[model samples]
Structure formats: structure tokens, C-alpha cells
Target: MTAVLPATLAAVDLDRTLIYSAAAAGDTAGLEVVEFLDGAPLSHATPASWELLAELAGRALLVPVTTRTVAQYERVRLPVVPRYALCGNGGVLLADGVRDPGWDDWAAGVAGRAAPLPELLGLLGAVAGQPWVRTVRAAEDLFCYLVAHARDAIPAGWLADTAAAASAAGATLSVQGRKVYLVPAGLSKAAGLLRLRRLLAGEGPAPRLLCAGDSLLDAPMLLAADAAVRPAHGELHEQGWTGARVAVTAATGAAAGEEIVRWLIARA
Candidate 1:
């Protein structure tokens, strides 16, 4: 008789990790469109990645953990539909494309422990007055983010000041690519993933957790996982963020997405 291995749970970030936008998709010739807006191509993944993702999904429970809003995440069409998704930086949970009311109630309780959105928005308003600030928008009514004309043009001191303010208000500030995020301290991707893991475990044995991401927002999730992987590009890599169990892919761009999928299948 052969020993049976326990099931595995894989949580993955979408943007710049498993998928890439046109600007980030190097050598787009063979890339397949994964997202579209108004019939215009928005994001893509390599064909090889799609095939590997399907295989990985079959081998383990795959959950998309992203900072994107529910509406934004819905735009993405993956080869395999995840049974659960963590969106809005863990502010919202979706089960089979529908919002989970229990998760909503839990998020409300968590939100009570953090500074109000209005206060954060006020701070963002002040920062938006700067010439380098392009636009500021709220996400899922849970957090706020700012787009800069040029990330380099934004003063380092200003970012530091914003971070301090957010910290004082029980929130965290993160800059990824050209966007600045003001996330409430109580909400995190790890929390959402853990909750989902518990729910899944109730159905069977607890699965080993594997995560992959490419940004600072994903740090908590990666840290919480049994094993994690990251691409060579994105905010986390630029910051030199690493951990004992975290492995980095050799390639960048869409190729990195494929590499991550292949790694997940092998690990599973």
C-alpha cells in the first residue's frame, strides 16, 4: 500500500505575479489575453502558464489572493475558476463569485479596530494636492490608493510622512509600481487566506499552504504560508524582502508567471 499525502492549498497573487499587463508583458507575441476592459486587452499570461495553472488547480485548492477590488478581479478570466478569492487586500471574500456574508460581518468587526476610512481619505486628499499626484481612489470602501505621475517624482520624505500618518491611524502605507496604498492594519491577505483554509479544512484534512506573490502587500500571506515563492520583479523584490521558506523565480515578466505555476505543481 502507498502512503497517502495530504492535500495542499495554494494562494497566489494575480497582478505582476501570475499575470501581466501589456506594459509588463515582455515579448507579447505568444501571450494569451486573460483580462479585458471594453473589449481592449488589459492583462495577459503566457500559454504555458495557463496550462500549468490548470494542472496546479487540479492538484491542489488554488485561491487567488489579490489587492484588487471584486469588480476588478472579476475582469480576470483564469483557466481554472477558484472556489474562493481574497480581494480588496482581504477586505472582501468571494465564494464562487458571490460575496460571503459571514466574511462581510467579520470584516466589519475588523474594521472597527482601525481608523476610519474618512480620516485616511483626508490625509490622501492633502497628498493629492502635490503636483506629482495623479489620482486618488477608494477601494471597496475599505482602503484608499493614489496614482502618481511618476513614482520617482514622489518625494521619499513625503512617502515616509504618509507611512507615519497611516501607522498612527492603525493602517499601513505601501507603494507598488506607481500606486500608493493606505491599508487598514487589521485587514490582511493572510487573514483572509487563513479563514478560507479553516473552512476548507472542515471538509477534510488540513492542507499544506503554498503562496506566491510579488508585492509588499503580499508579504503577510507569504510569511504565513508553509511555503512561498516570488518573482524577481515587483515591489517585494525591489525591497529585497525574503524569508526562510520563500523561493524566488529566476525569470521576470510573463515568464516568471509560468515559472511560478510550474513551481507550485512541483511543490504540490
Candidate 2:
């Protein structure tokens, strides 16, 4: 059983939201490395964001909701270890650093509504053998994505056609940086947030939800919140997405991460 929480429930994405890579970061000065891969710095956060995030962790239930798989999510080392995290686009949830079995079951039950994983993988054949595609693989058998070089070089109608096809297959497609993702319609960050809300409500009063993200997948989770914020760059911003209560950050890259953390701390 968990105790009541007086602070807000903050659900934030990882890459390009709270952290940024060298290419995505624009500038690294005054930023701290939060993740490293093969001994190389991979993701970074502004020093101000780091200090503010630590403070936010103390004042709120700061949950890192991300599209990364559990293993990949583990690679990140934030200043504050959040009590809860949703990885695999919410197909996997962790509580107090341990995977939550109940949440896994819930996600599995919902997955049945979507096409079989094999069918989803078949969709990959479209991009397979393409010169621009760099890597393609499944994540925890929950979703599939492909990283491409020169994303803008792909045929204009290709993504739209593929997205439409994915929708018919009971999934949604999103483009984030060099990655093209196809996620099951039934498995969503919003659904996971709902489960979190239910679990927290069982412990005490319902907490206000505040979310932040910079990509298309993050849009659902952001929209599900009582209030949300997004960086000026990324898919949603490019799409000109807007909501009655949602806010957009003034900066982009690593600097925007600091602005977003400050936004959460002030509201939380």
C-alpha cells in the first residue's frame, strides 16, 4: 500500500523533453550528462534542470514516462531517481525502481485488442532494405521502430501512407528525430497514466496531473494531463498542436529542458 501525496503528479518524457543528446542538445555548456552509452555521453540535461529536477522530485510524484524500453530507460541516471516510471510507451511501468507486475498484466490485456506482433513486424517490410533506414527492431515485443538517415529524403507520401496503414492495423505511427515508430493503439501512455491515477487514488486524494513532452507519442500523455507543456521543437510543435490548458516552452534543446523542469516545479 502507498501513502497519500500532497504534491502534483508530474509525468514527463525523457529524450528531448527532460534530456537531450549532443545532436539534439544544440549546446552542451552548463549541461550535465545524465546518460552514457558504451562509455560515451549520450543524453544530457542542463545544470539548472538537474537542480530543479532534484527539487521537483522532493515536492512531487515525478514520473519519467518514455518510449524507451525498460533496459534502455535504465541507462539514464537522472539527478533524482523517480519512484515511478513508464517505459515502452507505458507498456512497462516501474514502481520504486522495480517492475510492477500488475501494470504489465493490464497492458497485456489491452494488447489483445491490437493486431498480432507478427503482423506489426510485417509492416516493417515496407522500410526494410531501404537505403536510408539504419536500424529496425522490436521493443520488448510491444512496438516496432526504425531509425533512418536523411529522414527528409524519404518520399513525402511514404510516411503518410504507412501511418494510414498502421492505423488500419490498430496502431499509431510517430516520427521522432531519426526514428519512425509504430505503436499499438491499445497500449498508450494515457492508459498507463490512468492506471497510475487509479493506484494513487486508492491511497489518497487525487493529485493534479502535469505532463511534458516534445514528440508525437508524448502528445497523448500530455493531452491526458490536467495541464501540460511541450518544447517549441519536435513533432507536435511542427504540427502546430495546441490545447486549452497546454503550454509551450520558449526555448528548445537543452535549454528548453531547464525551462520545462522549472515549469513542473512551480506547478507541482
Candidate 3:
């Protein structure tokens, strides 16, 4: 009898990591549109990367962990349907295309331990009239974020000041690209992944974890993984973030997406 290998859990971030917008696609040509808005092309991945992702999905439990809203996440057309997905920065979990009620209850408990979303939203409103602030919205009813017209135009010390205030209120702050996120300190991708891991372990031995991402929000998830990979671009790279087991791709944009998929497949 042959010894069975433990399962592999590959959790990957979507935007800027596995997929890119036209503005971020770099030199990659023949892009496949992965996301559309009102029938207009919005996000894309290289044809090669798409094919590689299909192969990876067949090999491991492919979990797309993203900060995108549930509706926004459904817009992306991946070659394979993932068994599980964590969206809204772990605020929502989808199991077999259905929202898991148990996870929802767990998330509600986590939210209860933090400052209420309405209060955080009120704090955000105070700066919504700033010239550089483009739009402000609540994400999945769990946190809030503001879009800036230009990343550099954001007021000096605003991020630090807001982060400090949020911390005092039991929230956390992160600036990824042109978006500033104010999420609850008790809610994180790592926490969600750990819950999923426990649920998955009930079927058998725990799987070996591999994670990939390109933003500050991804750091906790990456750090929680047994092995992690990050694209050479995006917010994390911009801040020179790294970990003991984190591997980086040599390329940027769609090419980096391809490299990450290949790395996952090889490691799996």
C-alpha cells in the first residue's frame, strides 16, 4: 500500500496578483478578460496564466482570498471553480458557491469584538470631503475604504493619523494602491484561513498551506502559510515586505501571475 500525501491548500489573491487591470497588465499581450463591468472589460490575465491556473486548480484546493466584495468576486471568470473562497478580506466565506452561514456567525462574533462598522463609517465621513478623496464605501458591511484620486495626493500624515485613531477604536488601517482600508483588528485573512483549515481538517489530515498575494492586507495570510509567494509589484513590494518563507516572482503584472501559478503547481 502506498502512503497518501497530505492535501495542498493554495490560497491566492486575485487582483494584481493572479489578475490585472488593463493599466497594470504590463507588456503581456493576448490578455483574457477575467472581469467585466456593465459588459465592459475591466480586469484581465494573460492567456498563459489562465491556462496555468486551470492546471493548479486541478492539483490543489484553490482558494481565492480577496478584499473584493462577494458580487465583485463573482465577476471574475476563472477557468476552474474553487471549492472555497474568502472575500471581503475574510469577512465573507463562500463554500461551493454558497455563503457559509456558520462562517457568517463566526465573522459576526469577530465583528462584535471590534468597533461597530457604523462608527468607523462615521469616522471616514469626516475626511470624505477632502479634495483627493474620490469615493468612500463600506465593504461587505464589515469595514470601510476610501478611494483616492491620486495615491500621492493623499494628505501627509493622514494614513498614520487615521491608523492611530482606528487602532484606538479597535480597528486597523492599510493603504493598498489608491485605496485606504479601515478594517477591524480582530478580523483578518489569517483568522478566516485558520477557520477554513480546521473545517477542512475534519475530512482528513490538515493540508500543507501555500498562499500568494500582493498587498498589505495579504501579509497576515502570507505569514500564516507554510510557504508563501508574492508578486514583485503591488503594495507589499512597494513597502519591501517579505517573510522567512516568502518567495517572490522575478516579473511583474501578468507575467508575475504566471510565475506564481507555476510556482504553486510545482510546490504542490
Scored by TM-score, the top model is: 2
The full ranking of all candidates by lDDT, starting with the best, is 1, 3, 2
Ranking by TM-score: 2, 3, 1
Residue-wise C-alpha lDDT for candidate 2, range 28-117, written one tens digit per residue: 877799999999999999888898989988888888989999999999988878878999888998988899888788887787688887
| Per-residue lDDT over 1-268 for candidate 3, one digit per residue giving the tens place of the 0 to 100 score | 0133248889999989998987788854688888899989988888888998989988888899998989999999999998789998897999889998888888888977888998888777888998999999998888899999888888758888888889988998888777888899888888898788877787567889999999888899999999999999998998899999999999998889999999999999
RMSD per model, one decimal? 3.2, 1.4, 2.7
Worst 10 residues of 2 by lDDT: 1-10
The ten-residue window of minimal lDDT in model 1 covers 1-10
Error of 1 at 241 (Å): 1.1
Superposition error at 63 for model 1 (Å): 0.3
lDDT against true structure, model 2: 0.86
Candidate 1 per-residue C-alpha lDDT over 149-203 given as tens digits, one digit per residue, 9 for 90 to 100: 8778878988899999999999989887778999888888988888777776775
> What Cα-based lDDT does every candidate model obtain?
0.88, 0.86, 0.87
Global fold similarity of model 3 (TM-score) = 0.94
Ranked by lDDT, the better of candidates 2 and 3 is 3
